[model samples]
Target: MARIELLQVADAVAREKGIERELVLEAMEQAITHAGKRKYGQEHDIRTDIDRETGEIKLMRYLEVAEEIENEATQIPISEAQERNPAAQVGDYLADPLPPIDFGRIAAQTAKQVIVQKVREAERARQYEEYKDRVQEIANGLVKRTEYGGLTVDLGRAEAVIRREDLLPRESFRNGDRVRAYIYDVRREPRGPQIFMSRTHPNFMSKLFAQEVPEIYDSIIEIDAVARDPGSRAKIAVHSNDSSIDPVGACVGMRGSRVQAVVGELQGEKIDIIQWSPDPAAFIVNALAPAEVTKVVLDEESKRIEVVVPDEQLSLAIGRRGQNVRLASNLTGWDIDILTEAEESERRQEEFHSRSEMFMEALDVDDVIAHLLVTEGFSTVDEVAYAPIDELAAIEGFEEELASELATRAAAHVEATNRALNERRLELGVSDEVAAIEGLDPAILVALGENEIKTLDDLGDLAGDELIEILGDLAPSIEEANAVIMMARAHWFGDEEPVDGAEADEAAEAAAEEHERANV
Candidate 1:
């Protein structure tokens, strides 16, 4: 290629592809190097360089002068190199300039192919670097085409794709339509950079709100959380650091203009902006707005909340198809179960009766005594067994002697239950190794043995969800199940610290084996 022609081509390709001109020049040089290798011998070390300022092409064959010629193709003896140039020394590379070749049809096509491949690689790299950091930011683009229920969007300099599932429900984009979406992901693939866009992501709505509401962008009001039902309804939880600012009001703007802007972008999706509170109960109350919550019962251990609403507001709290409560649960990061006042009352009564019955059966106490125990917040035999004798004696009509007797009976009952469970576990032939896993209590062991998880290997092979399903309500949460499984598999990792009763079992086995060997 001519010097000026090469420079003009490089500049044109750089401008068109939106890449650095140096990259195009490097690609051209690589193409020249490939063509040179084909014209000369493929075994020779051919290198090519293009001048940045003048675009002058230089092709040369390089040979290294070594004490011993390792490869005749690319290495020469130091003495032979000194004959070519007296100043040449060992470990020096000698370059022989070659005239630029005139391209035939095949050579020109080959050079163009190499240039195209390298330029494409550079373009993909450029696109990846440009958009990788832009994930989660809102992007504006024109719909370029629709393929397989997905839309390809042209974002001026780059192209992105919004899969059908990522688009709003019942929404479609035509070619040339202006669209706004969140850059959910940018991935480097063999073909090119994959820019994944989403219109229905909760963050897209949050971003739109941030753009419309200056308080949110300026950090005066913070968007704590967002949950969406795509085109139907959504909820946003916001909090204000400034005591004077009303976070919900600021997001809603004058006459609901700000939220309306976000809703417009979401294709008429309804938005509820609620003020966030540090107190979970208060936050839940705010989340279930327009529906009056009569009471809330929170189980922090289980991360669940039972929300009781008035009978009239039950339907409103649940919304159409339980959308309201679902979004509220997502917003608060808690499992929410909505109940009516009557339902809550019935549940409470049933729980009271059940606790009374449990105490009556376990402690052999009368109905009145059981009711008293239940009223004093003693629900389990373990609680009664572990309670201080003085605390039980303080109960109305309870003497210290009677409290002590009850405590003794409670302890005996719990021991009996555990003994029965252990007997059953042994009868089922659960290996001591399985039972010795750190988190596997007697009940869990019985459950595991019943399900044929009778060894440590079996327990280790179980996934968290599998373990939870096997143990039913007695199983720990998924996180705890995973930890238990890891403990079970610890012996496989070579560190092999004995867990629980594993060391005792091993010693007993060794002693029994020694006895058998002596008898033999």
Candidate 2:
């Protein structure tokens, strides 16, 4: 009768907590196991089991039968084990049934704690399993409490947090207020499964639109990208699979009803819906809405775009505090430089004159020849110095001999520039450790010396992005920067001598020649 009552209690607890009946029974067994250990010696290997069907409790002391008894409390020799069970043998478990423990007040409290702790662990595991796959999903929760500027939300069976920074600017919630946010992360922490919710995340706006717009929900329209200045303004780029339907119009809905619904949820944040385009330039133009673009020059190598707008539209294109261009850059993943038509024209003429001067000074050429070289897209002395004789000769008014002379002057000028830089580098007291790094040229070494980075350790201490920022135009790509930093750091591992940059090059060339000779 008592065993049946115990089974009914387990079922009731499981149904109340929305957990499995077997888990509740297991918790009960664990609690009883602790009580058994407290009653018996703590050194004894104690265990407890509760039958799932009948909830009959069984407490036992586990002893491992061994040829020699090493542990008197938990291990017994086979002869001693055979007295209790005649068929017992070495390397066998000898489970001795223990008398049912009548819990005192202290023991009962300890048992209750064990059961509660086990139930809490099972609950946390259940929450983590349920929410881990739901990351990036929108969840509706009620604000339960606020702690240190962050809100704790009750998500039905589980709880979530909206950190203060993750909340939109100036947004506040009462204890019982309902909130909708994006589930950005779920982590299994030592205390419990933590569900991190965010209202400031850019995707939260897209999810709100997804909830309100049937076209987006049905997959006829897709949200390509989203950028937000939460509680102030946002931009969303959308594309439509069906050419007949306009994605922006569909998101805006009848008389702005759909977008207004999302805006209300975001606390009056303004939204700009733009059509996504395959061309980055076209997409950037669309992203900067309400301001006309006169022209867009893209530098694909650097992922930067220069936009020329009318002088009157400059303020509009840049927005108040440069918000429009900033959001546009974020949405299109391009660094945007906004310039008025007059400003762009002035910059263009200045660049043209600068390049012409560089060609005339480096190649010892006349103005017309320099202008022609600049027009032919030879921007630097190095470009002219390395160009093939045929390429330079192909320029109008340049014969083979003239092209060869121009290349020679360009090479001489570059060599002179390097020699001056190397002299300056030595005068700055730059160490050979920094100079020996593979990609650190004389000019870059001078720059590093001017910045007080005179040692290899100083260079190696910098992150790749930090090195790029320090070197400016002299910086290598991020991959190359990391490689150079690693090369500088290689000496820290052992007594191996650092390779000089020029010596390393000669060694590589020699290896290549040896390979060719071996093949021959």
Candidate 3:
């Protein structure tokens, strides 16, 4: 290429890819020089340069000026070289320029490839500098085009990619549309810099709230935690440092206009702005919004809650298809189960009858008189009965002997609860369907309501295709879900049942009933 044309190419490419012209020139010189060595031969000591004015490349042999020349490849006699062209004097070196670059055929082919690769590398480094520190920051872009699987977003100075996974579900961008995304990552690679953008990350919601809510930006209102279902719904837990300002109301904006703008930006993604609470129970209840929890029954060992609601409100609390409950459990990190009016009543009556029967059994045994054992807060009968004395003694107000008696009575209760629970399980039948959940999180169960993935055993049967079909884009994440399921299943079956809340209730009631019957 001519020198002027070379310079023009450099200018155009540098501008197009946001690279420096000097860097491009340096890259070109090094690349051409390397090609010169391989084409002619690395055996020759060669130097190459692109004339600044001509944009033409020049190659030459660089030999040292010496008293006597013995090696033709590297040394030249100063005196002998002077006779050829008196431009050189003794002790001075002369440039022995080579033939104009033919770059003919193979040589030309090689040079082109080198320049392309070098420029791509330079562009990648420049992009990395622009985006590496931008994590959690928002940027606006013009939708240049939508490729097969993602959108090309053009920032004023650079471009980024929003892939299918990064997109909020059911949301899309059209060519030339204006869009905003949270920069998720900027990676420098051999090919180029990859600027990753996301619209579905939880932090996106947090940052968006900060943008729309002044209190959040100014630190008057603080976002404690956020859990999201992306395009479908999101739950953000916020708190106000200044007691006078209502955090939830501030986020909702006056007449819901502020949050509405953010919602519209996300293509109508729903949001639930909630006040945060330090109390887990309160937080759990608040998290399950749109569904009023009449009462929250917590089992300490289980770290679970049984949420009781009006029978009519079950579907609402669980959300249209249970999204509400799912978000709540994720937000609180607690397993929750929803109970209705009839279910709660049956549980209570069963509890009373079970205790009465256990006490009646104790009365029949003479040695066990007026037993003063404490109900170690167990909810089910069998857990205490089959449980070890040490496990029972671990409960508050329990002694070794008391644990022994309680464990024995608990054995009976557990045996009974097991028989009944299993009979119900049998009636449900073991058909082709599998409900493979390891243990039940009442809250998560309530949230999952109808969307439940039955069991791990069942999950293993699902082929990747089937799993993908069930979750759509979420199908790829089935592995992670399976991991949690396996862990929970192991915990449910392990010796470490840890006496859940329901178990504790049974243990405590057994103690009270046994004491009453002995005295009578």
Candidate 4:
């Protein structure tokens, strides 16, 4: 209320809010200046200065010298300046201090409102400094409340928002529940600091592992890479500094107690701990664990791997709904394709039989059936899989219902063809062997999706572990695989021509010449 008391109020508020006293004084000056401008029309430049030392207030009015003083608010005449300072030149600009006008009632109210607004602005700036750098750091929050699919969390110092997409899939927090989140982003807005958080970040998993594993926390074990499908599964690749220290074992903990602790925080999502390997092939195999990979062909250019697992383990390698493979892809930074043993055979068979496979044995028209199916028509085995019953009925001399029956019977045969085609694709290098296999049927091949297999060259590149994954479902005979390789070796690399009499004599002469040179 009084001049002396303004200093005491400024000092006390500054100390309480941790703002500089000069800043408070500057704010007081600006606020009073604003209120004065509103009350006394600020058409001219107005300055209000507060002496922090004495708590005295002074207001000055400034006007530009103009030939004609059009508005009284902004211009002072040459005669007015000479009256105040007798030596003043006609062109000299002058400022006049307005005498202290008491803020009897209304001005006091305006000053109080101004002071309140300035204090709020200073407080906001102070809070922003306290929270801005916390971006990307982890923080714990209690679920304060929820509205419109978003969460408000109290992080002790400030509140943070956790968006629905930022949440772990299938995991929900109730009001008052404590949750940890990765600080994904933070922004200083006009209202306040907006701290964004996420429980779905892959780094959150890495941080959790570091917290749970003493070795990792201590730097004795380092997590090399991590892949995650938040709220479902994750794969982490870890390494140890000492050969004796088992990095994977340490991360897993005794009976998986350590990982379980982390998992509990994450609402039961599964984590697979794997030993990081320098060899990409070995790492890929390890990544697709629980499904034995038979071979892995690396495409370093694409950062992709064509992996082959046994004919039975396909589903397991790819995982339930492809989550396992998906996480592995993220962790490894690799594009992975899984192929089975039968698929390899079916691929090669289609390639080799592209022409000859259409011609039938002993029947000319039935042969036409194969020709039309492959040459002029359906490219996919699925097309033949669901080919119209009437088409088969139209085959020369084919009858009613007999045609449908033929379609029904051909259904099985079509599946066999597709399966055989798939089997051919997988034949190390020979699709022909898949075609020649006596029991092969195109319809059966189609059903088994065998025709989709393209080439053995394609199969040869796959990681064996990928094919081994197929064992979970289509368990093809391993012995048959070995036999196919043997046949392939015999057919392609084996004797292409009989040894002639002249060649035998030339071989004997060469051996004699070699023996004479050795003896010499």
Candidate 5:
């Protein structure tokens, strides 16, 4: 081809594929190199280079100067190489210029295939680089086609896919129709860069709100969290940096204009715009809106909450098919349990009676004393046993003598319970080493023994979730569980000393990575 024609072809291919012209030129050089190898001998070290400015092509063959020539085609003796260039060293490569290749029918076709493959690879790389960082942003595109219940969108620079499940329920798009979707995922696969889009993602709603609400886009108000049922209902938690601005009102707009814009695009999905609070209890209360909450009890350790509402508000609070509570749970990152007022009252009374009876039996006290103990926030015998003498004596109708007697009884009761648990653990064949693990009390040791996790190695072999399951309600939080397991595992390493929670997790992760490397 002519020099001008070479540059024109490269420029045209680059423009058409939206790739760099230099990449296209490099592919052309590679194609020509393959042709040169075919024309001469494949065994020879053939290469081709093209001048970027003038588009001049050069074909050459390289032979390495070696002390001894192993391959006659690609290597030459240092003595023979010295004749061509006296300064040539043993590792130096000498290039010999060759005539341009004459393109036969077969050679032309092979060159075209090579160039096309290289150009396509470059194009895919370009698309991946262009769209990878755009993930989580909204993309506007035209529907190019529909195949197997999914839409192939032409995004101008790249193509994207919205699977049927990712589209709003019952929403359909025909060819050439404009569609807006969230760029949820972008991945480089063998075929090309696959850009996955979605309309049902929680962040899709969040990004739509950002586009519609100027305050959110400006960072004056922020979308703290979002939960969606997709096409049916969604909830968004908004927070304002400025005290003067109401986040809910800003998101709702005047007469619900801002949120309605988003709802229309979402196939009329109902939206609940709630103001976010740093306090989890207050946040959860706001999350279950339109239905009044009578009380909220939080178990911070378990990341769970119990919401009590009026009997008539039960259905509303739970929503249809438990959607309201489900969305609230997702939004606040807490497990929510809903109960009617009557149910909560009955449960509370049952707990009070249970605690009173335990106190009466454990401390050898009367109903009045047990009731006072329960009222004074003494649920566990350990709390009474270890509590300050002054604190117990300060309770109304209780003197120092009575407080001392109660504390003595509580301590004896706790000691007896621990002794029984320890005896049971021993009977179950639980090792003393396992019992000595930090955070493993006698009750936990008995529980582990019951599950046949009787040895230190047995406890160490357990994953966090497995240990949690075996212990049931007596199980610790995941972090604490992992720490206990690691402490139990310390003897496996050179250490019998205990490690803290953070150090334990780090050690576990390092061990896991080491195991993975060994397997690989």
Candidate 6:
């Protein structure tokens, strides 16, 4: 009866804790071992084992057979060990059966505590193993409690937390309310496995759409990107594999039924399903809908775009407090600057006038000639100096002789500017070593000298953005800037000088394109 009851108790604990039967037996063994150690002697090598089929418990003291007894408690001389067993050998453990122990009140309590602690540790391990692989999955649970920091949710077999910040703005829950969230992360902590859930995660919205729209689940439509403002609004870019199916329309569903279901789940947050495009400009234009874009000026190297909208549509384009443009920027992974048509036109005129003035001063030409040069897309003296004679003569109303004269004047102006800048650079103690650096012209060298960066090491110490800031208008793209900095630091690494500016620029541009493709 005692043996049957022991097995029955172990089975009950295993079933209640949802742990393996072997784990319970192991916990029981450890508990018995602790009790035996307390009753016998703490210094003795006490061990306990239970019969798997019979539920029989055994207690023993193991003594290591040695040439000489080092400690009376755990080691025995081989001669004496052999007397007990004729085959006793050195390094072998000889077991002595210990008599069954009488369970005192204190011993029983101590054993129970040990078994409970071990069982709890096993349960925590099981929980962590089960949930760790479930990250990024949507989970449904009951709101067990609400507190100042967050809500504790009772998942069927485990508990999870939805931090205050992870909850959508103005959303609330009471006890026993059903809640669904994205399990963003699972971490094993000392107390237990911590499953962190979020209601406002961008993926949460994406997953909701995936559930509500069968086309998304079947891979007929793909979600390219998502940006959310939680309770206010969101933008999701979708692409369709089949040309016959419209990605945006499929996501919007028949009469907006699918999207409305998602909106209801998200507490009535507005959603925009935009068709994604291979062209970034087109995608960005699609992202900022309901506000027509008059023009788009993209700077690929900087991953920035200037968007021009009608003056009346400015408020709608930017949204209330800039939310629309901000969400669009987040979705497209680009910095966006919104401008009204009037502002863009004014800026363009200012640039044209500035370039014309520069040409008039540099080439010693009249405003009419300067205007013609600017209109012909000649912004710098270097461009005119190095341009092919055919290109210059091809401009309207320009002859070959006039083109040659203009090229000659442009070259002379560039030469004179370089000479003056070099003189100023020398006066500021700029080193010739800096001039030898590829991608750096005389003007940049002079700028560096003025800023107290006069040595190779000084230049090498600058980050790409810092160098770009110092170069101002002459700054190269980020990749090119980094290449230049690496060239300056070549000596530190015992490496040869890097490729010249044009080759380095080409390499950097190629690398940037490859990286962009990988990301896409």
Candidate 5 residue runs with Cα over 4 Å from true position: 51-56, 63-67, 75-97, 360-368, 382-412, 431-441, 463-465, 476-490, 493-496, 508-520
lDDT of 5: 0.92
Give a tens-digit lDDT track for model 4, residues 1-520. Answer: 5888989999988888777787788788887787667666778677798887788888877776656678778777767766776766645667778766567578778887788788767866776687677765788989999887779999875788999988887767789999898887878898877888888888888888888898998999999998888888888999999899999899989998999998998888888999899998888889988789887889785588998888889999999999888887887888999999778668746753663253332122365555654554444444544767776556565566655654555466666666766665455233554445433344322322342432332232222233334332343333333332232223222355323233533433343354456558
Q: Flag regions of model 3 displaced more than 4 Å.
A: 1-13, 49-58, 62-112, 299-302, 362-520
Off by over 4 Å in 6: 495-520
Q: Write the per-residue lDDT of candidate 5 for residues 1-520, one digit (tens) a residue.
A: 8998999999999999999999999899899999998989899999999998898999999999999878999999999999989999999999999998889999999999999999999999999999999999999999999998999999999999999999888898899999999998999999999999999999999999999999999999999999999999999999999999998999999999898899899999999999899999999999999789989999998899999999999999999999999999999999999999999989888989999999988888899999998899888999999999899999999999999999999999999999999999999999988888888889999999888999877787787889999999899998989988887767656754646666777776665455456558
Give a tens-digit lDDT track for model 2, residues 370-438: 989888998999999999999999999999999999999999999999999989998888898788777
Model 3 over residues 291-371: C-alpha lDDT tens digits? 788888897544788999999989988887778888898888888899987789898767655655554464333323213
TM-score against truth, every candidate:
0.84, 0.79, 0.62, 0.59, 0.88, 0.94
* Candidate 1 lDDT tens digits, 1-520: 5799999999999999988999998899888899999999899999999888887888999999999877999999988899999999888999999998888899999989998998888888999999999999999999999999999999987899999999998898799999999999999988899999998899998899889999989999999999999999999999999999999889888998888888888889999999899999899988988788988999886789999998999999999999999899999999999999899889889999999999998888899999999899887899999999999999999999999999999999989998999999999999988777777878888888889988776776666678889998898866677667766666554564624243433433343354456558
Summed backbone clashes in each candidate are: 0, 0, 38, 83, 0, 0
Q: How many backbone clashes does candidate 2 have?
A: 0
Give the TM-score comparing model 2 with the true structure, all chains together: 0.79
| Candidate 2 deviant stretches above 4 angstroms | 355-471, 474-520
Residue 270 CA displacement from its true place in model 4, Å: 1.5
Error of 3 at 394 (Å): 21
Q: After superposition, how far is residue 235 of candidate 3 from its true place, in Å?
A: 1.6
lDDT string for model 6 (38-122, tens) is: 9998999999989989999899999999987779999999999999999989999999999978889999999999999999999
Q: Rate the local accuracy (lDDT) of all candidates.
A: 0.88, 0.88, 0.71, 0.70, 0.92, 0.90
lDDT of 1: 0.88
List the pairs of residues colliding in candidate 6.
none
RMSD of each: 6.0, 7.0, 14.6, 21.3, 3.5, 5.4
Ranking by lDDT: 5, 6, 2, 1, 3, 4
Better of 3 and 6 by lDDT: 6
